[model samples]
Target: MPLSAALLQTLHSIVGDKGFTTNQGEIAPYLQESRNRFQGHCDILIRPKNTQEVAEVLAICNDENIPVVPQGGNTGHCGGAVPQGGILLNLSRLNKIRQLDGLNATITVDAGCILQNVQLTADKADLYFPLSLAAEGSCQIGGNLATNAGGIHVLRYGNMRDLTLGLEVVLPDGQIWDGLRALRKDNTGYDLKHLFIGSEGTLGVITGAVLKLFPKPKARACAFVASESPGHLMDVFAYMRDYFGEQLCAFEMMPRFGLDLVLKHITGTTDPFAIAYQWYGVLEISTSRPNTNLQTELEEALHPLFDRGYIQNAVVAQDLMQAEKIWALRESMSEAQKREGGSVKHDISVPVSHIPDFLAETSHAVCNVVPGSRICAFGHVGDGNIHFNISQPETMEKAAFLTNWEALNEIVHEMAEKYEGSFSAEHGVGQLKINEMDRFRGGVELDSMRLIKRAFDPNNIMNPGKVVKI
Candidate 1:
């Protein structure tokens, strides 16, 4: 149903003419997600300037029983931000850095602040905010916390949930829950901030956040390693973890096919070795203490792996430029896959020990289902998260190959369950994996989620048709 003129008039009064737009041309960008998998329509796109304005908008929407979709950056892999109807609430205008407490090592900022701007803010203070991702340039901090984003540095720093100290959210009923306490330990009650951290905007609008920061690393080292197989790479990872301890910042794995894709499509990237190997690993170690000679230590660590034949070859980057070149190959995996053809992507995780068997078995299963499919698997091996993507065969049509998306996902997700793993690892369950929630999640676990959804959003006005369905 279209929003009534009276309700629209009231909403317009709360946020002036600049905050609301009904023009389709101005609203076109917010209607589609990055993947183009989900396209949405909205009666109006409201950009609230502050928390009070957001509360007022939500209060009116709730009173009218209108569906509201809160969008942040719109960079999510899942379709969480895509609106089904009613109003689309975008938090882009609420961009502000509220505070920076050096003594407490926390920085407070509004939801719409771009992620890269936050990182740069911390850098200027000689502190670090480690929630880094490829979309940091445009992705908002609210979206990062909403999705509980994980990136390369998760091996050392942890995800957005761990990095967050507190949040300022406007509840579904227009009540502002100012739980933005920047403390190291707060045992006052149930950690309410946690409830909204990974909720994907179903509960409330995350207006502001207080996040933890760390001392910037002064010493760094990087290496590109080659191994015969995934098993050997795992062995190398385990050894590095034990050797480097907390200094091991990132340990990423890449298959030979994935590297070839990057070299072929992405310019200025050359293979790190003279001869290609079956599998590869990118290792990074850093310390906040200056002049730590991490490169020499990393070089010494590789000698033992070569002796055990776990690594066929290795190259330790001697300078900052060389290290960045090595990391670029790992970062370019996803874009390169797109250049090939249609890709059926899966973000999955299992026990770090089970990755080798999981890959071997899942690869066989996928090929059997779609013969000639190219399996391009790579991700954070240290954290056990693998992006298992399948490219269509050269002879097959892209649309025809994508028709197997559901079948292929079922096969891979079933395998992940067999190994006692999660179907949605870091990517939150938006509209894409709602069915998987019904399939893999059930009993008290799922029931409790639905109960919380009903309790928090009784009107079902907050991000309707997302996360949990009541």
Candidate 2:
């Protein structure tokens, strides 16, 4: 259904001429997320300033039976931020750090605040906000929470859902529900905030949030180690857990192809090792306690593995700069791959023990399905999440390579399912994975999800045709 003139006038009047724009040129950038797979179209773009304004805009849209797609930094890979049609609600102006309670170790912020800016603000107050990702500089808190983002720090602080305490949302009917209580333990009947955390805006539009903070780490040690296989990495994780315990901050895995791409594409990025290894794992240990000897503990734990031939080589960062340099090589992987060619990326997770089997089996299956495809699998090994991405064969045309994406996804997902792994891990099921969700997610789970969707957004106006199909 098309939006009526009266409703457009109401939306325009609420946001003012400066905020409302129907210009395709102006709205072009917001149509697609970082992945560039799912593109959106909108009747008009709405930029509401505050919670009240957001609620009013939503209310008017709701009355007119218009769908509303809430967009933040537009940096999402899952296509959750892209609008289907109707109104595109831009939350960039809602950027405000409402409060920073140092005593309680909590910070309340608007949905539009860029993730890196949030980290910086927390750092200024001598605290740590542990949700660090490559898109932190551009991705907004609302998008992060919407996707329940799991980044480099999931080994320590956990995902966006765990880090968040409360959320302020504008419901389908334009009513505001303020659950912004900064409580660590709340014995409430139902934890409603969890509903919107990773709903991908299907439930409601997240406007503001109260997030947990941590004491800043005083010391850190990082290393890039060569693992014989994913199993060897698991063994290393056990060793780190047995020794460093809570200090083991991150454990990331990298396939040989992923590392090679980064070193080849990104100038100045070098391989930490002289010889190419089948698998590599980057582990970091951080401590808030001053004078903690984390580096010594890491070396001690690796001594046995080094002797046993489980790990081929290892280089521990001696200083902060060196640590960042080593991390830069790992972090540049995705961007470097993008520069190289079209990539079919999957953010999937399996059990820690099954990671080895999943990797080996999925690699074999995907390559067999699409021969010459390069498997560049890597991600947070601590949480068992693998960014199992497939790179186009160097000889193949971009269009021809991308034509096999769905087939490649099938091969990867089949093996993942065999390991009892998720089809979509960190990235939410936006428009891109709706079909995957229909196939993979069970009837009971889908029914429950639909029930919640119906409860909050019965009219199907809030991010319609996303997460689940009605």
Against the reference, the lDDT scores of all candidates come to 0.93, 0.88
Give per-residue lDDT, candidate 2, residue 431: 81
- Model 1, 248: alpha-carbon shift in Å? 0.4
In order of appearance, the predictions have TM-scores of: 0.99, 0.97
TM-score between candidate 1 and the true structure: 0.99
Model 2 regions more than 4 Å off: none
User: Which residue pairs in model 2 clash with each other?
Assistant: none
Winner by TM-score: 1
* CA error at residue 58 for candidate 2, angstroms: 0.9
